[model samples]
Target: MRQLLQRLNNNSLYVIISLLIFGKGLGFCLNRKFFFYPPQFAWLMNNVFLDYSMMIAGIGLLVYVCLPSNNNFVLGVLLAIITVLLAIITCIEIEHVIFAGEIEFVQNAISNSAIIGFILWTARHYSKR
Candidate 1:
């Protein structure tokens, strides 16, 4: 397990996770009805603007992860934006748990938190280069 983890570098992990997020964002934008929203989150049920914003943020995260780290300023700005967006999403997931009393929302909350951690790890790796 340790060897497998050692082989998975930060950038590769970031790209893989970003692709998953991109897929989720695409699904959110293209088929909002497919997702199950608790009554408390009714505002998220058919919010096209939020859906597109998520997709755009996913795209931005993908681009940020893939781009060369030649310029720290651009990468830092992107990282900040991505971090804020992800934090917001994670907060919403936590809110769902609080408002709806659903334990399942914890999975999404944890996943988003992990993604944020990976993003920060990747950023740290790049900054060290």
Candidate 2:
């Protein structure tokens, strides 16, 4: 059990993923009554943008954990690229989702965010050294 736990903590991708997910989940739990989104930002934080952000964050988590040991640069590059993609996609999709009145994106976003949370937790269980 100790050995298994040690292996998980050494994974950086897992740590990032966990934090991102925790961040997203925090948002949802804080605004449970608002099933869709806040009225003040109806033009922003649309379902599409939210989903896209979650996806990008998810991708970041994947690349962080998937890169080879000698490919730290590659892993970092991938994470950066995916994060940018997520941000860009979210910005563009926000207006569209708002106009269309579709809010299903939150569902996908939350699901993916939860996945990141678990991966992050597992990663943190391993050895840091």
Which structure among the candidates has the greatest lDDT? 1
Listed in order, each prediction's TM-score against the native is 0.67, 0.34
Worst 10 residues of 1 by lDDT: 2-11
The CA lDDT of each predicted structure is: 0.66, 0.49
* Candidate 2 residue-wise lDDT, 1-129, digit = tens: 564444445565455653564465446435544433346665454444554455556555554454434454554454554455444445434533566565665555455545534544543453323
Error of 2 at 31 (Å): 5.3
How many residue pairs clash in each candidate at the backbone level? 0, 8
lDDT value, residue 68 of candidate 2: 37
The Cα error of candidate 1 at residue 85, in Å, is 1.6
Error of 2 at 78 (Å): 4.3
CA RMSD, predictions in order = 6.2, 10.0
